[model samples]
Target: MSHMPTNIPDQSQIWNGPAGRAWVEAQSVLDDMFSGIAEYLTAQTRALGARQVLDVGCGAGATTMQIANVTERCVGVDVSEPLITLAQQRAVLADSPARFILDDAQVHDFENGAYDLIVSRFGVMFFNDPVAAFENLRRATRPGGALRLVVWRSATENAFLTTAERAVEHMLPDLSRRKDGAVGPFAFAEPGAISRMLERACWSRVRFEPVDFTASFVLEALELYMTRLGAVGLVYAELEPRLQAALVECLRQAYAPYTIDGRIRFTAACWVICADAEA
Candidate 1:
C-alpha cells in the first residue's frame, strides 16, 4: 500500500474526489492549455541532463511523458487516482516510458536521492504543510539536483482565472470564507513566502522568473470550459436553470471585450521558480 499523507488529508480528499474526475474528463484540454509551460520545463530538464526525473503532481502525465522522451528514467506521482489512471492509460497508448503512481507526494516514500530533476507545472501548491512537503521532496532529490516549478503568480493578475467568477459573483453565495495563502491554487503567489519555505526545506539557489502569456480559447467553448471546473463551476452548477442561463449570458458579455476574431483571450501571470538541492 502507498504511504498516505496525514498532513494533507483535506487536499487529498479534494483531489481524489470531484476535482480528480473533472481533470480526467478534461485531460486533453487542460494539457493543451498548459503545453507551453510543459515544453519549457521539459527543455530545462533536457538542458540539465537529468538522468532520473520525478514530476511532482504530474497531472495526466503530460509533462512526465515529455520528460521521459528526453531522460532515461521518469516517474510521475499524484494524489488523484482518476488523473493518475488517465495518465497511465495515456502512457500505454503512446508507448511512452513514463510511469504514474497514485500516492501523496507529501509523504510517499520516493527512493532517497533517486531523482536529479524534479518538476511541476501548476502543481506543488495546495500542500497544507508546504514546508514539510517540500522537505520531503528535497530528500527524494539528489544533492545538487534541480527543482523547477510553475505556479500562478497571483489571482488578481491572472484575469483568465477570475473573470468568470467576477462575472457571476452577484448570483453566487458569499465566498469570503475561502482561505488564501495557506493551501490553494495561489498559495505560493508571493515570491518571498515561497522562497522562505523552500530555503527552510533545505533547498538552495532559489530564483523566480515571471512568465506572462496570453491564453486563448474558442469563444463557443468558453462557457462550457469555464462552467465545468473550479470553485465557480461547483457553485454555478447548484444554481437554478434560469439563473444558470443568466450567468452564462453574463459571462459571455463580460468576456466580450476580450474576444478577438472569435476567440476569447486573456493574460495568464505565472512564476517559474528554480532551486537546487543542498549539495
Candidate 2:
C-alpha cells in the first residue's frame, strides 16, 4: 500500500499539529456555528437513504458520521493526519463503519461510479483547483448520482465574523489589508463566481439555496475569541510577551456585546448547492 503525505509543511500541514489540535478542540464551537450549513446541504441532496457516500474534507468526520447513521457506508477524506487520527479513533469508539483516510480530495484516485453521493461542509472552497477537483468527484459518483455542497456567502453579511475579527484586527492591523483569498477562512463567496465554477466542473441542474443559521456560542468572551476568531492568536504571537496578555483582555471587551442570554448569537449566510452526476 502506498503511504499518504502525513508530514507536509506549510499552512496546509499546520492543520495537523498544535494548530490543528486547537481547531479540533473547538469542534463543538465549530459544529454549533456551522451545523446548519451541513444539514441544509444534506437535506437538499441526499438520496433518501444513500447506500454509499463520500465526504470530502471530512474534518474529524462529523458530517461523515451523520451520513453513515443514515446510509450504508461512508468514507471521509482529509489531508491532515491528526484530524484523520481523531476521526479514526472516534469511528472506533462510536463503532461506526465510517472509514477515515488521510488523503487530499483534490486529486485522490477512485473508481468510476464508486459512490452514490458526495457531500461537503464548507470544504469545496479550499481546493487549489476546484475545477479539476470536482471533475474527479464527478467520476467517483455513479451515473444519476447527486452532490451536496455548502459554502460561505460573503464576509460582509456575517456580522458575527466581522465583529469578532475586529477584536483581533485591533491587535494586528496587517490582517485588514490582507488579500481576501487563498489565506482567509473563505475564498469563494461571490454567488456568480460559484455558479461559474460549478458549470466549469460539469455539474448540471445546480441549485443554490441560500440558508441562514444562528450560531449559539456558549464560551466566554476570551475563550470564544481564541477558538472562533483565532486571528487574535496570530497577532498576539507577533507582539512582545508583555503585550499579548493585555491584547487578549482588550479583545474580550471588544466581543462583549455579542454575549447574551449566556450565549453569543451570531448569524451566517451559506449556500446549499445540489447537482447531478454526469452520464
Candidate closest to the true structure, highest lDDT: 1
Per-residue alpha-carbon lDDT of candidate 2 for residues 1-279, written as tens digits (9 for 90 to 100): 222223323545656655566656767677666676666545643544568789988887778876777777888888778778888888899898789768778778977899888888866665666677788888899987888877667777665566545665655667543223343445566656666767777877888777777666675533644633445544444578666666657766776777788877776776667788767
lDDT of 1 by residue, 72-189 (tens): 9999999889899999999999999999889988889888999999899877987767777888899999998989998888877876677777767677757332233646677778
TM-score between model 1 and native? 0.92
Worst 10 residues of 1 by lDDT: 173-182
Compute the lDDT for candidate 1: 0.82
Q: lDDT of each structure?
A: 0.82, 0.69
Model 1 stretches astray by more than 4 angstroms: 1-9, 176-180
RMSD of candidate 2 to the truth, in angstroms, is 4.6
Which pairs of residues collide in model 2? none
User: In candidate 2, how many Å is residue 77 off?
Assistant: 0.8
